[model samples]
Target chain A: MVEEKEQIRIGIAEGAILATPGTLMTAGLGSCVGLVIYDDSRLLAGMVHIMLPESPHGRPSHPQKYADTGIAWLYETLMEHGASHAHLRAKYAGGSQMFQALQMEALRIGERNVRAVSMQLERLRIPVLGADVGGNVGRTVWFELPSRHYLIRTARGDERQM
Target chain B: MRRLQVDPVTLDALREFGNIGAGHAATALSTLLGGRVKMSVTDARLCPFSEIVDVVGGGETIVAAVFIRIFGTISGNMFVLMSLPSADRLLERLLERLLPAPRKAQEYTELEQSAIAEVGNILSGAYVAAISDLCGISLNQSIPAVAIDMAAALLDIGLMMSGDEENQAILISTSLVHDGNNIDAYFFLLPDLDGTEVLLDILRGKIRHG
Candidate 1:
């Protein structure tokens, strides 16, 4: 049995694509979407901590911050790393409402982010295998590349695997 | 990346602004808890959005928070954060009057959550009132949104208020203490780039005149 103890943790507005054996983790996804693209056969996994749906005003300094650009960038990066788009599968978690009282449509960023991520995946012709989204909670996700599974842990200590 | 030009004069002015706001917020919090409260403006600067998660410990630090979005001349985001233990202490102090039994549960009850949100509402009201007076700006707050989650998650919402990741934001961080317990509280005020620019101009004008 191989002991896999290492993991890569990515921060806000960050993305990581790892071919390594360990798990890839991203923490504190409230309205943000933890979009993971995995090539099961090649053991290549990528995660982008996307905060906003789109770059409305202009291109951001960090391409990984917006769903539109970040998803595209992650797709291209994964493809360049010897992963075929045909073999890529998408999984996402987070994008909880988090704040209920703020009724402004703009403040409903979580719903928008989820929609944007799904749209981008559809545009790329990628199938979304699983998702855990839309609630007034926060989540942290850990993706294991070797097994191609994602474990989501909520702030309330509830755990879900996808 | 666009550099947010906040000169020394502007920084000093912002520090003064934060000091006055924190003073009022401290008093409001003190009145609620029936204890002495002290708040100090530690730093006021235009910082990168990515650094916000690191401000209140690391990204995954579990925290209780109240978030309010400002909409007006000083449009931005305001939030108060404290560790779960500190939050429990606050709930214990508040629930005595708010609840009949005043029992501490492993998880926060709805009333306990409301109490925490009310505390945040009061403190943010005081802070905004001071800023409106000093900057002479008409600022309105959205409804208070409360949550107990990871520090990183809350910070992400605060950063979202800024919109553009490339632009710099005004970060006014305050250290708060109550009854000598040294409650690990963080009061963050983040203004968008345009709002920050307007704020710097107002500060410059104030400094130049006075």
Candidate 2:
């Protein structure tokens, strides 16, 4: 008989890191982006759920709430915890346009968040292995560190592995 | 933006605002459905942005939500939420037929979606009219948008419009009950900090003059 691993749930504007024998997940992500970076060989992974694209005025009380700052924080934290910088890979999900009628530029927060996260990952030299983004629906995502399986579940009850 | 100090008097006034608005909404719903509708002001207070999902159930709780953006004298977001079962019941009443249980929101037909949106439009219109009359302010609303998804996903729009600096929101929560049908619906009014201050100022002025 095998034991079920522990699961850590990340809330809005929050992040978590897990090693082997654990899973990290975030739920009900609408316009928000759920980003995961992991070192497959080391079995270490970190995830951040970001709400906005950029943090105004440089730094805010909660850096994890923004894409640029949150990605940077996650990268540094993972590196500090013995994850190899060269071996780090990324996969992300969420960032959906929940309301399709508005059409205002400011209301396109979902699209903007996805662009910001992608740019940051590129600047940091982290390759994006998979992504599920830019739609008119919400998503929930889970990442298993040991198996390195990234699962995305859409609001319509469709589940796919990235 | 600085956090607006919500005094006890302001909280009470907000509750009263919710009560009157919800009362009008219930009447409008009752007339539309041709049934007795009862309303209750469940909770009106300052809630952290992170905990807003918990108010509905949880982050992952499936729900049917209608969103309307408020404009003019006071600007913010308003939402009408219902559990899937409650939404199904409401749909049955609106469409005049029994529907098979839906496994997910995507299973709803186009006609059903529009029906739900129309309900949101009527209820929010009535609620806003009551508030406008009470405050003596002009307000307008955008066309309602419907989303049947996780409660947190549907609510993120409200938090985004409320501004990133502000972590807490003044939530005026209300519930509607349809007599003889057991349909339960929730209403949330999330006004921005600036909007709240303006609303409170007008309310205080009316109190002083009276």
Candidate 3:
């Protein structure tokens, strides 16, 4: 009997980390950041689907909903799973201006989310290897643990690897 | 992320408002297609933000979505979403008004996209106008934005319009079906937490004054 590669699904405002011989996937990223971090040497990858830049009103009940907390949580989780912090590299997609008709700054949540995620990663000294973001489209993201590559597919059926 | 639980009274008020709004929207849609359009408010409630993805058939359900951002005394988002097949049916009926013998199956063209946006604009306007008249409060809406994508992706755009801390959405969902359910569509009106509270307070005030 042969075992199949396991694929774990991460929903919005959630985070997950997986080691080699598996896949981590998240779908429908719009005005949200799908942050993926990997430690090549350790063959460990983590993904966080962050919905907002910050939790301003009060203490956030879900850590994965905010970029700051979510990225921090993902970083810590990877470390706990034997991933070396020094070998961590990041990539992300999403933060699109979905409502191109709306010119208000408030509607630019996608851009804000990307900026927040970047800032948080920088604070942890993690370098972002690549990103496919912005524009007026949504994307689905997947991280392959074996190759440590990121796959981003747009709503228009355009796919890119980073 | 403490989920806000709206009081039952507020939920009832929102449902009533949604019923009236959905009726106007359906009438507007019927007028557009020059055909009888039946829209039903199946359920209206304050839903946890986390579960909306599942309600709309998960993250990858291909859908046509129209968004209208509302501002003024209260601010939120209004959306019209349907499966691609449903959108195709609606678009065909809509385009037939401008063209003779429109094809039933094909990729959506730029002209069809514009027509869909216009239809969405009219329907959303009717819905918002009804709410404004009932509440006696002014509401301003943005030009309609259209997209074809996964339901979760499209819904994320609406969720972003709400405040970041909002954990719950007043999901006033309406379904429009055609020809014994060959075409099925969903309409959603989501008001942010603060906006929901304000709307309920205004309704309470109106009731007391009346």
Candidate 4:
């Protein structure tokens, strides 16, 4: 794993990152929220690309695709690599209205997912240090290890430390 | 009941519309990648939101990459989906980099998500704009967001169909043409037939009045 010097691209219906020192980077988030959680102490970080805000009432498929499930998975995975609540910090980015034809409940998937991720983070008390959430701008987020900073880049070339 | 009807005329219009939009997206993509790679536009399908399960899912819930949004008072869910190979190819082309296929995949990195979101933004933005221009309707596009997972999560049919005959859904299954693999883009139009017809009327008015 140490010699794995490679950059991975996470596509639609996908997510990827390198938490081990220099093996991590990714982006392209819209409507779907991207959550970057890392344990600085352990030098571990994970990027979660979620589409929907919640799991369906009856069943949940593609646990990695929903904020509720992906956040939990990220927490578990991060903690497995030596992360604690105190050392655990989460940053959020993306959640936009790309489609201009749906309103009310039908068109609020972005807001809904952001709310859900926020709630889950609160429940875990992980202390979300920053967020660039809820807007009509598609974003690209990068979780750099060692520095443990979440770099946010939007579609319109807006970059910031979120 | 009366979900989206992909009649021959409407189907051709939608396909042409998708083609124009996807072409614009390809232009943006080419500039970003420094390569002239294009995503060809394909056919269109109209689904009754309720049947999205089979449309988006099979034995295993396929990965559904979605860009969620709202335009005016309509529910605009832009979805990109395919089997695993389809997803990989799209990502590879978009990244213009070497992305390892972790045998067991977990999460999308922020860059990857953003890049994909960028892809969604380009395509959807061009799409909505074309629709608005052709239909002569105004649309306020939100930023592009993305999620990857099973087809169900991508489509979220449950929410669309939770109501009775009144608040149903009309899904427009549109395909884009490309070399490597087939990628399907779902334009899950709002369920209310009334709005769609009104929208069509607006489109008609554009050609008629203009």
Candidate 5:
């Protein structure tokens, strides 16, 4: 008989780390991005629900709230937990422009968040393996460790594996 | 702007603000629908960003939401949300035709979508107008946008516009009921930290002067 592994939920502006046989999920990601950095070989992963593109100040009290800081924090945390730096890869979803009619610059945070996450990941040299982002819809994403199955479910009732 | 710390008096003032705004909104809705529209200010308080969706239902609750960004003297986000059935029923009343039975995954037509947006426009306009009159501040609203999706998905835009520093928001939620029909809807007023401070200051001044 197989026992059920832990199912952890990452709330808005929050994150989690998991090892083999666990699932990390974050729901209702509108402008927020759900990022997963993983070492598939070792079945280790760290997930962050990043809310903003950059921290207002150089250092943020909540590092997981900003893409620039959150991505780095997730990467370093993964490395600290026995995940190899060379084998790290990323999958992310969300950062959707919820209201398409609004053209204001501030409303474009979704695009900014996506760009920030990508830039930070590139800076850390973590190659992005999969991404589902940028639309006028919200996404709920979950990463399954060991299997490395990253799944995305949109508000439109569409589901896909990333 | 300083973060808003809610005291008992401030909570009561916010509730009164919601009460006045919702009263005007209910009147506007009644005028538009040509029926008696009753509204109740259900819950008015400071709610964490994580719990805002739970007030309406939950993150996964499918809703038809009309969003408008408020600008000018203070800036914030306003949303008028309704359950799928309630939205359909409201559309039926506006279009004067029976809608098809609700689908598992319902999509609103462009016309239906506009109707909802216009309703949101009038409702928010009335609410903002009441606040403006009460506070003597000039406030403007952007064009309304409509979406049908999970509550959490739609509500997050409020938090995004407010910035990351604020984990909590001033949520003034009101429920509207259409007479002789089962139509029910919610109005959410989410003022960012700055906006909350300014509004609270104005309210405090009014209280002190009187």
Candidate 6:
């Protein structure tokens, strides 16, 4: 019997993680999406902490700063760590419109980002198996490594999966 | 009991000042947000710290706040806060095309520090320019430092309005509108005896111009 004592923690703010098994957590999702990818066979999982859907071109404000750059960074990092693209799957959480001062249409950055991610994932041939997205309230998400199960909590309560 | 007060005349002048400042900010913000990111200068008041409304950012949140320290006339601080929600919106617009996650805006990483700092820089500079032109004073606007909580935001506000604030410090607020969210920009300028006189003179000039 082997016991894995080297559990690592991924703090979500604009960062990435790749672990064969570890706890990746991000708290407070408000119109921001948390991306999680897991490769079952390898027991490898990675998450990207993104604040926006796109980071723009030419002038990437902070390559790891926005969703556009952050997500790209996550994948590349995962690839570097030995995860096969074919076995990867994703789960996302958080995308809410809370402010009443912004235009309903203008505030759709969250939705737009979600769309962008879906397209990117599709292009990468990675399937999205589960997600808890879009709401008026903020949430916290924890992706349990090795298990590929997503634990989510909100002001309302806690969700066991997805 | 005419014990020095800010009346309709003062409020109007301040409001007008806000209007002009906001107009300038609108142009700058629009350029960045990819279109006209709506903005409005809500209310202005002359009071002490006790009168200022306070907000708290959960410890988990990292707030990007920019503070510009102004010398001469009104020696105080001017700040622009993304107010978490607004920050999220701004980042979403800033990075909608590069990543593969649900379109929702979520999860912030340390990678955002510089970007948020730059934003703080832009807003603080823009605000100082507006105020300087309006007051017609050549004041310096310092680069903003990123802060973690609402208390930090208020403390920044406190610095300028501090000192024998035995009396209340005036509060001038601007609400920047974007994607249905309101970003609160607080401007706190405390006039030393000299600053008071200068502010009054500027107020007089604005009235004359109007």
RMSD of each: 3.4, 2.7, 3.8, 13.3, 2.3, 17.0
Considering TM-score, where higher is better, how would the candidates rank from best to worst?
Answer: 5, 2, 1, 3, 4, 6
By DockQ, the better pick of 1 and 6 is 1
Candidates' lDDT values, in order? 0.80, 0.83, 0.76, 0.59, 0.82, 0.58
Q: What's the C-alpha lDDT at position A17 in model 5?
A: 94
Interface RMSD of 5: 1.8
- DockQ values per model: 0.57, 0.67, 0.48, 0.03, 0.62, 0.03
- Superior candidate under lDDT, 1 versus 4: 1
- Which lDDT tens digits does candidate 5 get at residues B80-174? 88888887888888888998867443467889888989988887887788678678888999999888777887877787677654646666666
Best by TM-score: 5
Instruction: Show where candidate 3 strays beyond 4 Å.
Output: A1-5, A57-59, B1-15, B35-38, B97-107, B164-166, B175-183, B200-210
What TM-score applies to chain A of candidate 2?
Answer: 0.95
Worst 10 residues of 6 chain B by lDDT: B151-160
Alpha carbon deviation, residue B103, candidate 5 (Å): 3.3
The single-chain TM-score for chain B of candidate 2 is 0.86
Winner on TM-score (1 vs 3): 1
Off by over 4 Å in 4: A1-162, B3-6, B57-60, B73-75, B102-105, B161-194, B204-210
lDDT string, candidate 6, B107-165, tens digits: 44545544565666666566567667777776775455444232222232232233332
Interface RMSD of each: 2.9, 1.0, 3.7, 10.1, 1.8, 12.1
- Give me the runs in candidate 1 sitting further than 4 Å from their true place: A1-6, A57-60, B1-3, B35-38, B42-47, B97-106, B173-181
- Model 2, residue B88: what's the lDDT? 91
Q: Which stretches of candidate 5 lie over 4 Å from their true place?
A: A1-3, B1-8, B104-106, B164-167, B207-210
State the lDDT at B132 in candidate 1: 75
When summed lDDT is taken over every stretch of 10 residues in candidate 4 chain B, the lowest stretch is: B157-166
Ranked by DockQ, top first: 2, 5, 1, 3, 4, 6
Native-referenced Cα lDDT, model 6: 0.58
Best by the DockQ measure:
2
| Model 3: per-residue Cα lDDT at residue A9 | 93
Of the pair 4 and 5, which is ahead by TM-score?
Answer: 5
Off by over 4 Å in 2: A1-4, B1-8, B177-179, B204-209
Better of 2 and 6 by DockQ: 2
Error of 4 at B25 (Å): 1.7
